[model samples]
Target: MIITAVLPALSKEASIGNIVLSEIAEYKDDKQISHPYNEVKGAVLNLHQFNGHNIGVIIPAYNEENLIGETINGIPEYVKRIYVIDDCSTDSTPEIVKRLTDPRIVSVRHEKNQGVGAAIISGYKLALEDNIDIAVVMAGDNQMDPKQLPKLLEPIVEGRADFTKGNRIIRGYWKGMSKWRLSGNFLLTWLNKIASGYWNISDPQNGYVAISVSSLRKFNLDSLYGGFAFENDMMIKSNILGIRMMNVPIPARYGKEKSKIRYNRFIIHTSWFLLISFLYRISNKYLFRFHPIGIFYFTGFILIIFGIVLLLFWPVLILGLVSFTFGIALEMKEINKSQLRGL
Candidate 1:
């Protein structure tokens, strides 16, 4: 005689261990099952290996005392190093991390509060110094799921991409996100596509990301934007360097954590920075590189300005619009050639 056991449905916030437990429990209830729970869990958790590559996780934290410990604890055992950059947290964040006896943990505290971008940069610098093969960025708020980290690392590990980022917009994974923030993200996604020349990528603002340290060595880290626009700027610079990027579908998790971003100010400031960066990309990638695409963009803008300033220039306005459209199409074609899709 066989007895069947009932298991509760796992929620979106369920961890890998919990999910594995549920699966193992269900299998164990069947008479035909043979694998033990610990064996199954170990198999699921240690699914990925980077050969000899060293993987380092960078956790940029700011007063994340409540959830920081959980975030650090959730990291997989395969990770070689965990760089926690405390941005001068006023709380006991530093103390809590210190209490953890994990030898892999490297605590770096700023004398004053640097922005999140600055903290990540510090981690990147250290990773580069230590010859880390891959560096991943996860928020200290525990919002990024460790279960999905392998998704971000796979593309880079397989030599398919130089950079990989978590895409929360796919598969309705973003349903857990706040509606207002989702709306704002939708607007920025299109804007970022144009500015960064990465028309195929989505969820440009998602901070859960992984980068090949070799790619990091290609650009000047100090030149990157030091605030919320940092991720957007990374996309722009990566496109300029012709770096291949892949988007991994990862679900968004919202718990008791509150966002520190002020979207009203963020939108205004980031939009302006994107515009300037767009002009720079056009100039650097096209004009400086002797590509004719820049002429189309410049002439289009000049004609549009003249068309608006002078009356009876409607024909010039139409020509300007067409020229700009051609430029954008050509740019997208060039960029798409190097873009990689999710697994």
Candidate 2:
């Protein structure tokens, strides 16, 4: 005989802010309940003080049934709206979100599974329609700390930056990350710095971010990259548009959530995307603007190639390297001047 059941049955536990915790176990041969809810920290901010800003949080979820409820419940009361973009989750993710009684929750289900980036774009569009003054992004897996959201908002709230993002590398905050993941993040950070031209920003991969809706209006949202490279692409676009970006030091959180990314494929694809984006940024910001830096970059590339082909012309290679370095230094100086310092 074969049998299937949700071991221990579906149970709901009431928590602070009337958040419901639905503990449902998957049916298996072992009939074991393995899903564990990581205890999310309470909000540290006085919600009333932030009521003036129409803040909206965009949560992009796919197959995140285990912690979706907790993630939603963890959002601070200061946020005026919660846009949960359900990217066609096969599990009970959609149902779980629907069950939440929070009036602030606006569940938007996709007809088919799109990438997380597409999901976030959908939420951004909705936030715009609602005229949200600020938009923040947090993963649906509960990996982001809700309590630290205030930190990300501080710079923007103070009119210091148009874009603010979490940086896990500062002050040993990235200790929670595994060695392999940390190494991969470091590699991507270097590539993204070159691609985005935000030399001052680190940890470009951290998705915990906040941006003013005004900045979002400047972007052609439909043209943005709709994949895991979304964050990196956003940074590149911001730098091109001269957006003021600030980095807030936030700690990394790892719990029962499993990473959906396949790093091998992700690195290859994102690296290529960054390279192309680098060229696009250079063309738009320097060449289109008739900036002399473009000449240095183009000349350096041609000279370096010819110098290598003509092995006797070693002096040409040195000159090309100097030209390229000078162009990069000048670009960095310009970007640094526009970037706002984090509080």
Candidate 3:
């Protein structure tokens, strides 16, 4: 198979040079089948030119003492710098990160525990100040395989996407991930699809990702949430900016590394955060940031409001919920949740 050949080359180095679309046939995503691959091939060709580019990888750690070394060790030599942000760990995670002697690796310790989002933002800011062409995120727990790092960068390097991430929801890859994590990621990813205009994107929760500097400045990182919501929320922000975001399917490797995420917390947190992020992105992009076909949205909104006021004041008016439903249905159609979820 085409991927069988390309996988070996890609795994060895971040650059899979001279790869043709035909060669990547085995990795051809069915979701993308309708889009054709000439675009992807062109992007791949462009990706080859980014060798020797300045790159920074952000490894955010909490209590990941058992796995931090593997993450630091597997980083490709070509990366310009590695930053480990220790979010006030109760364990030896910060000490372990400080022990890494790679000249390119820098360790930053927060005085108190900040959320994953804060750590990532801090890392990205440092990377940006360093003037790196690309900024990558690979968690300290070592769930991300270094082999797929190049693939995540390919789309960004090729100008196909300003941001790209690892998508573990290949259905086949679900086996390697815990059922709880997998299910939660699926829900959040689906919600993200509805919130952001980017559709058919898989695995929004996979933190293994790369972003172009252009994409970084477009977001006000300080305003985003500080935990798991960060990833999904960032995608929504990117979509609002008309920045292209895509995913490369990657196999997940979850081991004994303790998951900082708890299901009950995630459920309560993700629900509230998703609603807030969706509304913020929708308001900014459709209402305040940029204007598209929002004349209809406002008209529909006003109609629903008027209908509600009329219905409240007069029992003769029965069209309140109907009008409100019309606006909501149109909004949902515009966002296209089902399409984005790859249904």
Worst 10 residues of 2 by lDDT: 1-10
User: Best to worst by lDDT, what's the order?
Assistant: 2, 1, 3
Per-prediction backbone clash count = 0, 0, 0
Residue 171 in candidate 1, Cα distance off native in Å: 1.4
Kindly indicate the candidate among 1 and 3 with the higher TM-score.
Answer: 1
Task: Go through the candidates in order and give each one's C-alpha lDDT.
Answer: 0.78, 0.79, 0.66
Candidate 1, lDDT over the whole model:
0.78
Clashing pairs in 1: none
Output the number of the lDDT-best candidate. 2
Question: Candidate 3, residue 341: CA error in Å?
Answer: 22
Off by over 4 Å in 3: 1-50, 289-343
Q: TM-score of each candidate?
A: 0.82, 0.83, 0.72
Residue 237, model 3: lDDT of 80
